[model samples]
Target: MAGSSQKDRKKVGVFVQHECPLNLLPREIWSSIAVMVASNSIEDLFNMQATCKEFLGAASSDAVYKHATMSYKPLAHFLLHLDGPERRFLDRCVEVGNVDAILRHGFVEYLRFGRRDKGMELLARASTEGNVEAGYLCAMLLMFDHEDEEEVKRGVQMMEVIRISRKLESCSKFFRGVFNDAIVLLLEMFASE
Candidate 1:
């Protein structure tokens, strides 16, 4: 958020001037702008990345993909159904430091594909690894996956960990409302115990 990554999205212009080569832009600026541009229009960002190797580094970055998926439902939804080969490609994306990708994989496996135990295991691992979305998902799954009070308490603790974090911005504004409702539901569940 600070230091090297400040307002990177701002640098990616809607249109780079015809007179100026993109290479002329500062390296960090160029990458940040490309990622920002990717945030809004992934196709345009991919086109820019396709222009050359340097742009590829920026456009294909974990931060870029994370921002894109978190910001756009279409991208997230598309990821939910990735077939084996596509998932292998996605595995590369996550290898670049995107824990969200792993979390999403777990989510799709658990929710959409009905691989419940596998999904729950991945979610728990990801949450322990400090992925906040994973923490949120793990909490929800724990609530439903068992009747054990200890599991419920662990889930509540996970929710509390994220509830007050300054990084709650990591969850999209749309998802935040859902998460808040979830917290309330968890509270009610805890009270019933």
Candidate 2:
């Protein structure tokens, strides 16, 4: 046979590599494997997402986001730039009880602190959904003593505005240490009267 052209050689290489180890697996099996492999390492999980569009779709999913917190900064940037569906995905992640997803990607503390009105705007939407834990999250962010009174007041108002009972209960249960500050503040307010 004549010597293969460089283009032909490249084509052969591509054909030989066509069936990536991931693509050959069934969808459900692939999802399971991705979940197992992505268990602890956020970077590996991110690289896995780059392997292919299918993998990326699966990896960016709530199951993966919950485990890896994959959608944080970029998701925030999307919102800042007005990237709608991407922002909505972050919203869904929060709605689905994805704490890691929210803390990992959604809440940009510095941005929130600097632009209090806009941050509260997003939190207000989250709160109206009755996302009580989200309410407490805003409250807790303000609980930091270093925050100014305006920020603290916004956080307290968020707690009062959140109508979700279950999340309120969860806030009281999971974050007792943080909740204590609110109680103390209320007591102090009463005592001063």
Candidate 3:
């Protein structure tokens, strides 16, 4: 029994050493080690990412989900309902670019605080593109409406700039108008300060 216990201890030591070897190791190997660790605390998870690119990439899976969870409970909970492939695709988004990451994190702000016109325009575009996932949210927003909420109402008015752009016949002109309006609005807001 003692001999068997010794073997088990040695096996555990080998696994630990293999994961976080003291000797200089290749980047890929080091990253693989980082992934093997199970972290329960958010602080430890972030610390692991800061350790190296391999760790960052390895933790990207947890990081993306964690970021979403911290930013929006509903969005995170909704994502959990997705099948395996969609979840895998989201992990890929974490690796490919920050755009998806930022959008996911900013979803609540867009939903609750963005100007009504801007939010509606964005939803219309999403609908036109056949984004079925956005359907439920689009319907809910229209039903509840931001006008009833003070903070959201402010965002709705600020977003009226979107309407001015919609008057143009050309799609390009419309976008250009939005860009110009954004710049002007920023300058005016800054000047007021």
Top-TM-score structure, candidate number: 1
lDDT of 1: 0.65
TM-score against truth, every candidate: 0.56, 0.40, 0.30
Model number with the top lDDT: 1
Ranking 1 against 3 by lDDT, winner? 1
In model 2, what are the clashing residue pairs, if there are any? 72-105
Which segments of candidate 2 are over 4 A away from where they belong? 1-21, 26-41, 50-106, 109-112, 138-169, 176-193
- Tens digits of per-residue lDDT, candidate 1, 4-73, equal 5775656665865574475677677766777678656545776887888878776766666554443343
lDDT, candidate 3, at 187: 71
Greater-TM-score candidate between 1 and 2: 1
Off by over 4 Å in 1: 1-20, 52-54, 61-69, 74-89, 125-131, 147-150, 160-193
How high a TM-score does candidate 2 get? 0.40
Q: For residues 1-193, what per-residue lDDT tens digits would candidate 2 score against the true structure?
A: 3565654665444344466665676777666656665555445766887888988876766565444344223323432332354445455655666554454233443353466555554555554554565567667667563358887787667666543443566666645643454456557667989
lDDT of 3 by residue, 1-193 (tens): 9888887874444343365553356655644444344223334546777786666776656434423222222244322233464445344543444333333323323644655565555544443444333333344455456455764554344344333545223433533543465566657667989
Worst 10 residues of 1 by lDDT: 70-79
What's the lDDT for all of these models? 0.65, 0.55, 0.44
Candidate 2 local Cα displacement, residue 55, angstroms: 4.2
